[model samples]
Target: MEQLANVKAYLCAVFGAVVGGIVNLMGGWSEDLTTLLLFMGVDFILGLLIAALWKKSNKSDTGALSSYSAWRGLCRKGVSLLVILIAYRLDVTLGVEYIRSAVIFAFIANEGISILENLGIMGVKYPTALKKALDILTSKAENSESVK
Candidate 1:
């Protein structure tokens, strides 16, 4: 019983430290960001399923699970987080906090669209308006990128 208690305490300490480290490194964490992370995870998992397990049309090789693709997914997710970090730093430097919120909102929208697409590939019929809205948002993003 004493050994078990010691093990639990040690695990709790490690978990607390890791969580604290992430919160500090991210310049603070919020429920919105948490939801975005969850959505991103779901998107990645569904993508893997669509590629490796689902008999879906070959929209691209990304629909098939390969180690190369897995690594690519990891890199993409990492870059997403890095973008958020950069946004937070920008907010700090500019003395304005809106950049982080904007970045998080953009990422959440993108993740939501990816999740919906993944569900569609899995044979779920989503509302037509949802796709249209996503298309509009995507095009707007593209336009903004082109302007930059």
Candidate 2:
């Protein structure tokens, strides 16, 4: 079990490194690995939920999601990434890195919130200070554009 955990951690590191490289190529900062992993995990689970909720009735049906449930899922991811990209773009245009940092901070906060929720669901307790810190960072990020 310990070995499995180690393997998972290693995989996450590799994945984050690859993503970090991509972000770097795009001129974005190589964010903290923990944040990247959290975003990937959340994005993946959200994608899975979207698929499940909008799942085709059978293997034959191959059109877009017929139900609003599916649309909602698509919208969620779309909005989240759009916000991130817009922030990053603004950062590049205005010659300040605040927007990019904001986007990263927001994602990190979101992932941290999800982590707390998951831990609670598993009957585990989390430290309040951590959540509080994340909340502060998220709030700051939400107003990042204003700062710069």
Candidate 3:
């Protein structure tokens, strides 16, 4: 039992170190990055709930939970983080600080909108103005991606 516990602790420490290294590479965990991560988590959970409990996910033909859709969502989030990592590298290379923040903010807005949409699908009411603002932000983000 002690041996097993030691092995578990060792593995956990290794995992933590790897994740920490990746986080350091990706702009070192600013408030913006933290918020973006939080938003992503919330959006993901809400999507799952909409599919599982509400049976209203639009990502599937039957508007139900789908493992493929879930996997794709996780992949998209991973790619978003990779983009942030690239933006951070750009900022470092250019000796500028805003590129990473810009990318993070764009993702934050996108995640926020997704959360709102999931809420809407679950019959939750929110302000129209808020949705419109998020729409505008997401559109700008999309335009920026196209430009780049």
Candidate 4:
């Protein structure tokens, strides 16, 4: 048991180090960024719940959560972090710290809208302002995609 405990401790230390390194690589991990990640996690969970609910209600043709959708969601979150990192680097190189905050705020807005949508799907009613804000974000995202 002592030997097993020692191995567990060693693994935990290694895991911590790896996580720390990744956090550093991903632009030093500010509170806003961490909160955004938390929001992403909650959004994903709510999405799964919504899918399960829809399946139970027999209201949709395809309401099951697939591994492909899970992987795509993870990839999307990873890309969001990558974009923030790029923005951080740009800010660093240009000797200004504005870009990172702007990027993070945009992601927060996007994730917030997603969370709200998932809640709405789960039958929660939200204010009209929420819908308007989501629409604005949607348009902004579309405009940006068109630009690219």
For each candidate, give its TM-score against the true structure. Answer: 0.73, 0.52, 0.86, 0.77
By summed lDDT, the worst window of 10 consecutive residues in model 1 runs over 55-64
Residue lDDT tens for model 4, 67-144: 677677889988988898788788888897667766776787788888886776678888989778767755665554
Question: Per-residue alpha-carbon lDDT of model 2 for 6-115, expressed as tens digits?
Answer: 99999999999987766654456555434655565664464444345544222114522345654564576456655666767777898886666767677777777765
Lowest lDDT sum, 10 consecutive residues, model 4, at: 52-61
Query: In candidate 4, residue 93 scores what lDDT?
Result: 89
Q: Go through the candidates in order and give each one's C-alpha lDDT.
A: 0.77, 0.63, 0.88, 0.76
- Candidate 2 residue 23 Cα shift, in angstroms, is 2.1
Q: Each prediction's Cα RMSD?
A: 3.9, 9.4, 3.0, 4.6
Please give, for residues 55-140, the per-residue lDDT of candidate 3 as tens digits: 88889999899999999999999999999999999999999876787788799898988888788788899899988877777776
lDDT of 1 by residue, 1-148 (tens): 9999999999999999987887677778798689779988998888878888984524445455677776777799889988888888888998976677667767777988988978988988889897777677556555544543
Per-residue lDDT value at 15 in model 1 = 100
Candidates, ranked, lDDT: 3, 1, 4, 2
Q: Which candidate, 2 or 4, would have the higher TM-score against the true structure?
A: 4
lDDT of 2: 0.63
Candidate 2 lDDT at 31 equals 53
| CA displacement after TM-score superposition, residue 117 of candidate 2 (Å) | 1.3
Query: Candidate 2: where is the Cα deviation over 4 Å?
Result: 1-21, 42-83
Identify the runs in model 3 with alpha carbons over 4 angstroms from their true place. Answer: 127-148
Listed per model in order, the count of residue pairs whose N, CA or C atoms clash below 3 Å is 1, 0, 0, 0
Give the range where candidate 3 is weakest over 10 consecutive residues by summed lDDT.
139-148
Residue pairs of candidate 4 with colliding backbone atoms:
none
